[model samples]
Target chain A: MDGNKILVLDDVSVRYRKQDSRSTSDIVKRILGKSPRNNEFWALKNVSFSLERGDMLGVIGKNGAGKSTMMKAISGTLTPASGTIEKTGKICALLELGTGFDREMTVKENVYLRGAFMGYSKEFIDSKYDEIIDFAEMREFQNSPFRTLSSGMKSRIAFAIASMIEPDIIILDEIFAVGDGDFRKKSQQKMQSIIDNGDTTALMVSHSLQSVRAQCNKVLWLDKGRMVMFGDPNTVCDAYAEYLNTGKLPQTESLAATQENPRNRLKKNTGKRLAEAAVYLMLLLVIIAGCFVWSQYDLLKSYVLAQSLTVEQIENEAANYHRQIDRLLEVDTTRWDTGIFKEGALDIINEEATYTDVAKEVLLQAGDLSRDQYKKALAAAEIEAIKYSHMARLDALVAQMRTEFEAQPEGKYRSLMVYAYTNCDRFYDLEEDCENDMQKVIEEIRTFQRKAGQSEDLADRVWNAYKSEKTYLLSYYCVKLR
Target chain B: MTSDKANHRFLLSELIRRDFIKKYKRTTFGILWSALSPLFLLLTMDVVFGTFFGRNMPHYTIYLFCGLLLFNYFSAATRSAMRVLYDNAQIYSKVPVPKHYFLISQSVAQAIDFAVSLLVFFIFVAIDGINFHWRFLYLLFPMVCLYFINFGIGMFLSTLYIFFRDINYLWPVVTRIIMYASAIFYDPSILPGIMRRLLNCNPLYMCVDYFRQLIIHSTVPSLSTHLIMIVMAAICALLGWFTYHITRDKIALYV
Candidate 1:
């Protein structure tokens, strides 16, 4: 390791054990004095490279060519099975964007979160919030929840936050490949500016050889875990292109191995290989556990609030019942989200934030359209009935009730009869209390009785039946005089 | 290097803030839910277990809440920590901070929530006619101890979860088992001698039992209990810290 070099890799290699020992029986057998054969694959080998201050090296390799493994080692995320890596500087990498973003948090909140993960202070982030938002063109949407934004918008926000660091060494993995044409140009210019500042060294991995050739001072090429070439961008990329084109090595002289680049004689760690090899998922009961909790602020609040409000018979019960059936909704969904009018459970739905209202509906309905249709018709009819009085109200209410009664065989007319009785009782009670307008009330009752589809002699027939039975349930005052 | 430490602390606080906000965002009741959730659990447990233990236990709800408060902090902290690496994989793979920061941030956030919920617990204490003695202040010792244990358990679980994702599913069940074993509801005195002895082995139970000794019994636990709590905490912290250090670099690869 040279003192002036920002990073030095002396024949670093990473090895992954094969899948033989992953089986429990195999592991058990191995534990019981049975030695397992060597089964391993080297993902990277002898990948020696060095960088000085302000040096930009572009890494190019095909899939499974050890490019990502090298990046992981350089970023200090993955340890090498053999060889050694030494670096001297504050380093940061952008291997992925929006990695830790909480889907429910706002863009501004995500900025702080991403910054925290990047190890930046809040004061520094606070100072740069405007610049970050401005760069992403997300000034208006800074407060919107991250899940609400488009995937493209999310990447832009992530990029803006990741680009704010001014560390001595920066590692980037396919960050410029995000966003649209305009955004791509904007970020590319930003990357160019960061490089031009002259103090930071960078190692970039890209499939775009044209970009690497244009931007990098030197390029490193790899093919199937071997370092094919490490030299000027034109020479290395041309050689890589020729190799890909012809399926053979380009006849070019290799970079002379300097005194610093020795045949790295680091010890291989066979013990560490065991743990990483058995990393495949355990053969255990895979419970659908993510089902337990949801964004419960709404659910819990709704639970407490739902308890305090007075029950409005069917309407409140329907809301409560809807919320109750859903395991998650049982905890959340307040009246604000679920706009239920008291007369009979008519929901004035807000299309944008309907889930806060509709999630319970799903839990209760669960793609059952018959119940939904009945509910919609019932609610609409109830609202219509309550909007009018006497004749018109009874006519419409009975029509709706009959339709609802006919649709479902289970409830029959039981539910409708109860509602109708309640309505009749309410109307009669109104007629009795309105002593000042007895004539008008009586006329209204007569009109409603006709609206019920009764003939003109119905009152006479009812009087005769009452006389025959010797029953005088209705007094002269209680009866509507014709 | 001074800026580096400052940076870590600042990052820690920001993570805590994010955890807090993400949990309660768009929630109607916000932080009040944190306090109210325990009260809700206490009521359910009291009703279900009330007939069995209510008559025998003095101030049954208060006793239940004391144990619940501590166990809940552990559950919340570890649950939060459990998902820190996997959930944050998108960022964790990119950013180069030490992996333990994620777990530490979760613990701190849960600690803040636990602290807030305690305020609500005090409200109940007042309503239940529980007297405010100077000894109530002694509850701070167990509270601090509980926080450390929570952080330690969280770190350990987070590391295990990175390697074996089944641990995520296993966690809630484990916490429930701990809660039941911790004597959160029924009295341990009702158990057989062997089982009661085993309760001493569970760090979670020991912490909860000590906390109850402070808040409910209104006295310091005997020196042995104190020593047990301290030793268990140290062991958990050391184990968790060691696990984290060993597995820290490997976590990125798994993600």
Candidate 2:
């Protein structure tokens, strides 16, 4: 318990009660003195050691071997289930990466925060602020939020603050793993410098064998939570390294060498090669499938669009012709003897009758008509209307078709465009109407551009195609719509 | 020996200030948070429980605040002490100072926060234009009594925490249970006969009642009961000191 001794742990044992395979209710019953099956895990058993002034002790062990548990006990982060620990000086422990740092605070503020947590006054921290920053090499980032710092930078700052407090005993738990190679080396050197000051006793936990050999004067080897070896650095480290190599004590180099046989190396290489090949094959398959899916989507879209447009055009023309026939018949009953009707009554009546029959036939044939049949019907109606001086009715029908074209469902119109683009035969037959429709679309887009205060060049390709061959204009509209 | 003790006391004071400042260093509210905690608690508890318990009581917020402020100091101090050793296990492990210093510092820190909170309560009382009596000066008696009571409990629990880590989880439950048991938000006189007798046995309730009587009601607590409270507080202090002295060496081993 004397100040000269610095730190001592005698016969430390930490045991955790393993839970029963039974339910919690069963465990409660067992607590009332009923028998229940259970197991026990000893995190540390019969661990004993002493640390002297200026001593640098490195603790090394495999995962779950209780190295951390021992550090916790020494640092007073955890109480031993059984044992005694005595210390004679102020102790500071850095058990986590950036443990006391508040991410919302600036680097300067976090330095003071950590200082305060270690029980240092604000004045003390202020005096040491520059030294802390210099050690962390983050002078430029002093006002930056801790959350903005890289992990390596944060660890460096944390280490700087922890070390600047000048405690008699400094306990570090695996903090060396932070930072890049250069920063890690610098940090290691700084730690070594602290130990070299001879006023501080350092207890470090690290898995790096090289670090232990370089920095520690004494080595403590923990195995399954028990102190297996405690002695000079070279002897303990040698034994520990041997244990790692051969999974046993008294290891021989020749045995270790022979254990690393070429056959195993070859097997590992082959496994790696196979894994690489599998990854490459997976990547190649993904690319091929992606291209196939994209092309298939394009084809499907074109087919549906072409079909929808042809159907919409045929339906609109038939509807217009039917409406005209209805008007003509209404006149025959209501206004047949009027003066305007007397002038062109017979001719108009004949044309109306012809259109009525054509509309009914077109409506009937609409379901079976391919793209070609619909275009032919449109052309035949245009020629007949021209001969009978019913060109106005044909223009009305064209106007009706244009309105229907714009109002068609987005999916149906898109599929119709894809259909027109994919089939060159039907595309040519519908070229003139498609060209006119494209011109109308370009005009509509230009009007939208003017209203939206955008450039006329927005739809130049469509206007240019309309001015060129009609087939090209049709193809352009089909592609653009899709 | 006295100089060494003075140095230790100085260290304890430094730790108290550090603890208080650390809590609000990066916070924009800063020291205002210390005052805000109790003020918020007083307002909430007054609104919630005052409607039912405050019909007969005059200036209920003031009455509730007076008692609540004192009780809050006690609860905060003891709760913090219950975890003080565990929270600062690192310091205890390496430092050769008396373990009671940490507990004392924690109580002192809470006392400072309570003082700030008291100022806020006074502002409210002033705004409400409550009449003051010269006997209000005696309010210090109960305040000192509460402080000692909290200090004694803090010392006891800080030592206990080194041995039992489960004390950390048990503290909040104990605090909530004692909150209703004490005369924090309501007058204890409203309790039924047997329950009132039981409440009388509570040290915190007696201390708070004394404050209410002296400050709000403008009367001294019965001399006999005051004497009993002083004796009880002395006994707790002695017990706490004895427990700490006996267990001080073992804390570093345990924690």
Candidate 3:
């Protein structure tokens, strides 16, 4: 590792696809689906530079010279299409004025939010929060939404936040362009302080040749994405200044003497390879985990369902079973015969209907059954018991009611009807009984009405009850007869 | 490195807070809008769908509310997520923070809004005479599943939006179709089995139906239903993350 070098760009280049051309021919071509002719070009090409810790590099270039692109590449915003960039430590960037802030948020919230964006913990921000606000000289405006601040105020806060955090690297892209004179002096002092610390690297892109010449230890000059010179600040800045004033390109020979440093160049491709591997690994993990979860979904669902519902519904009837369910969740699910576990959970739910000693014995024997046959036998036993209970009660009630109705043939009477809707199929034990009982009751009521001949009013009452209940049971009933 | 992770978590919460504050800024109703907005929407839907053809069905308002609530949250979260990259271009374009953080933050803000509306929904359920059951707590499962699915869809849509402005017009129409197909107003149970199965394939419909199962019918959705939800959430999240990851390099330039 090059201990002194904190940032390295080895033959870095970035390409941008040109915005869709608006010409009539292009539109027609697009509409015709000919893939709108590839219009991408390199914005930055083969730009190699390295920054030692605490080295402040000034980048000077004319408009469209890819200066900002290089800053973005260095700041970790834009990825290089064809080369590698290796940098260590966090970067604090002021790519543009008011660029990274939510304008509608209060100034304080934006500061914390941005601080979080830069990977500073809230406790750290809380400690430095007052100092940041004070340095920006916006104590009163801190509570006001960020958009309400003037441009100068915005720049001040932006600079204060960027500078205050003490980042390992700072990228300033024409940040000095907007602020007032006093604020500029303050920010320059702050930059000087950062540089004097002798460990924080800084990259500033500026059109102001004077400040670049004064503040930067090294300078890079670019023209149309090609590096013109990279070396001592005076030599490169003077060449750039002359190019601007006289419209003459610097001499190649003169610039060759100040070529990029050899010692700082990165010698390994490990960083890029590692990043690529991590992403692929993540993709693999997502796929594997997905399949694993999918295959085990029944087990997972059983475990989660049992655990969640057991807390609320099964506490009183099957309190002892709670520990079993809890242990089912805690133990390794991969080893589970989920068929048995699921059946066991369903049987526990049917613990409510396990009134008879025979059913209780069957429930007790559930643990001994073969895993495959367990679900079916346990479910059948639970269902049969539940059916016997509900059906026997209904049959007895109907038999007694028939005798009473026959004796009171001339009297007006109100009959109570119970509708047992078998709508809850999830309750495995109750569904069959409810469905059979519902059909039987409906048939029995029809026959009784046919025999009573004078039961027209009773027919209307039963129809009303059916209409109000809407096909499912568990509703009020008003069966009347005369 | 630990501090960085902690800060990223802090960043997520702060960004969510910022989105929440921005959403309510200068509005008179403020947080109250979270509850009242859904109610107002429910009232309009009730007037249109409930009174006209739904009088015979018990608790039709609650049924409609259940569908509308989930759909609105899904649409709002995803719609906001689609714009997250473009809207916060100033932030992530310059900073080194993960772009999905902003997407998650915006989506979470919408979730908090949905949570408030859910409380109101429960109140409505009580008023409609639907008994609250132990299964109602199972809502957290679907809510979590819906969030991941929405986050996944948001990632997919936001990437599309960066490359194609056509999606700006296309997405609302897609959301409308999702709303109609999700059986938000009408019950899917009345539909033919194949049609209902096709509709249930939509993850949004599954989430809506989960709510109906818990709140309207007071039953835990079948374990298979739970499986579908988990599978859907996982697949959508993976697909969204994969697309976002693959295209992330190209995004900054286009945005």
Candidate 4:
């Protein structure tokens, strides 16, 4: 935490909860009083390091080995689940390419935007704009939208904006990977210039061992999130490069390897033993209940069959009706009217119907029915046809009604009232049995009126129909009686 | 520190101006696209909504655009801010400056667009022979306040995004939800009491409401109410700045 020591990490460790490899249903069952297995994974463990001002530290690690996590912890993006970090200085970081450039904005604007993001003001950006653009080598198309720029171009722009703003300590996260050969050379030069300035301390994360050797004075080797080796660039790089060549520790093992003592190993082993014991017990329980589970399967199978049968019945009846209509249309063109096709056809196709009676009818007329039906009635084809025709007819009727309603609004309202009155008349004809149905029609019309919020004249038209149509009136009374 | 702030400010202006020009560099109409994009969007929204929500809407497009222009600036700026840290992660990774500048830059860029769109709005109003009112200048008060509010939101989100990339996907849904909930297209007065209250809670509502009052109603909104709104904006900006300061170091890693 001293001024000279720009960054320090003491025994930093990161752990993430690992999900159990169980189905969602299994998890739900566990939630409902059933016990679930537990698992945890450590991404970083017992990592310790320090960096001083003027020292260029290069962090090298394999992908997913917690290099990024460690960087994140140091950067303050991630709080280490354990351990402590003390730092001093204004830290600047270049974590990714084009981290702040607005693609829709020009290079100049993106620079300003980047500057502002770094807490700079508009006037400040104005002064440095040209220099930043010049460094990026994008002056020719600085006014072009960033989206129009190539990936390499975007990277250069981002790099230029970042490097232009001088900070006490700068962090670069694999930005050297961006751009072409020429631009890469320029980027390298720019990085060297920053380092040469002497006031800025830097941390660079890269996979390029050569770059680390050339540019960095202090090197940190991170293996699976732990500091494997640290200190002089040549020594750390040699050890790291050797470790890569052979999947083993260096011949002269670094202190980090021996730092994991027997006590820690015992603790880790005990944790593993506990987890294994729990898994064994669960496996034993499964084996003990294997017989009971088999017996219960029969009951569950029956229940599933019962539910599936209901669905099958509906599907069969719809198909049968659809076939009947298709046959009728094929045989007698005069009997079928295309104009009657409407929008509720699909809904009708999906309706449930008692298919036992239809099956009996089909069996009785096996000899007289078409060859197609005789061959496929038992195979579900007949049922499918019936469903299709019924749906098509319903759809046509709905479509016709909608068209008429739109074409003649007043007449449509009159017709609705007349229908309601007819239902009312039927109340008496059916000995008050139709009362409920009549009342439902009146209620539906009232609901429509409420929802319409139309002018009084429109409401009057509907009301007049209700008054004049005797059936509608009788149906309304019948409904009241019910 | 003062010199640093000045240097940063100069750099920010250049970025914003570049951002503005870059938006239309390739198009045939070029800069005119700035004026036309909003116009096209306004007209399309008007026609589409006019068929369903036309009644009670006097000059529906104008009314909608008034609120839209202001809201668009806020929305676009905040949306860009969501990615500001990640987009400029390169710069932050290498340079050290206060992170709020990026949020401000995005807001400023949007302000420029808002300015261009405002001109288009007024031109249409004049051509339509809409009455002129001196009170229209009062609209600037809310607009300026709204700019700060956007900056605050941008700072908070950009910092949050660095930690949770998921914030990126969630942001658009949140914006859309707020858009409909706010009085961007409809009059807040027509909404139910509960809904109206809820709408008032939206910070953008105050800005949009003020814009409508000044431009359409030709009257000044309650000064105290606006002052309260400005205070709210200031609080948001402060909170955003604090959050960025606290989380600024972490952004490079998370991004």
DockQ of each: 0.18, 0.01, 0.29, 0.15
True contacts kept of 1: 0.47
TM-score of chain A of each: 0.50, 0.48, 0.54, 0.49
The DockQ of predicted model 2 stands at: 0.01
The candidates, ranked best first by lDDT, are 3, 1, 2, 4
TM-score for every candidate vs. truth?
0.65, 0.53, 0.69, 0.50
Residue-wise C-alpha lDDT for candidate 2, range B86-193, written one tens digit per residue: 776655443323456667777788888888987888788777677766777777777787888888778888887766656788888888888889868766555544
Across residues B106-163, which tens digit of lDDT does each residue of candidate 1 receive?
7777888999989988887878787788877767777777778878778888888877
lDDT of 3 by residue, A1-482 (tens): 49888999877767776864345566678789986456776677678888999899998888988999988888878887766788888899888877778878889998998889888889988989998999999999999988899988988998999889889999999998888889889888988998999878999998888888889999988877778889999988877778889998876742353223322334244456557657865875876677666545444434443444433343343434333443433442322333333344344444632222222233233322333232333334333443344444445555665567677764333232422222222222445555455555555566666777645554455444454443222222322332
lDDT of 4 by residue, A175-208 (tens): 8877899988988898898898887888889999
Q: Residue A444 CA error for candidate 1 (Å)?
A: 99
**Predicted candidate 2: what Cα RMSD to the true structure?**
31.4
- Sorted on TM-score, best first, the list reads 3, 1, 2, 4
Query: Model 2 residue A480 lDDT?
Result: 42
Residues B112-186 of candidate 3: C-alpha lDDT, one tens digit per residue: 999999889989998988887776889999999999999999988998788776778999999999998999888
Per-residue alpha-carbon lDDT of candidate 4 for residues B116-177, written as tens digits (9 for 90 to 100): 88899999777756788877888788878888888888888888877666678889999899
- How well does chain B match by TM-score in each candidate? 0.94, 0.91, 0.95, 0.90
Model 4, global lDDT: 0.65
Top DockQ hit:
3
lDDT of 1 by residue, A65-110 (tens): 8887788788876778677788886677666644547777788887
Residues A1-482 of candidate 2: C-alpha lDDT, one tens digit per residue: 66678899876765554642335566578798776444546677767789889999999889988887777677665555566778876677777666555555678866765665455666677889999999889999998887899988877887887787788889888987777888778877777788999999999899988888988999988876756688788888989988898898553332233221122222332355456656655554564465455424433443453445554665566455543554444533231212222223234445553432342233232223444443444334433443334333333444554556677754444434444344433334556665665555566666666866877774686555545534445454544443
**Which residue runs does candidate 3 get wrong by more than 4 Å?**
A20-38, A238-482, B52-56
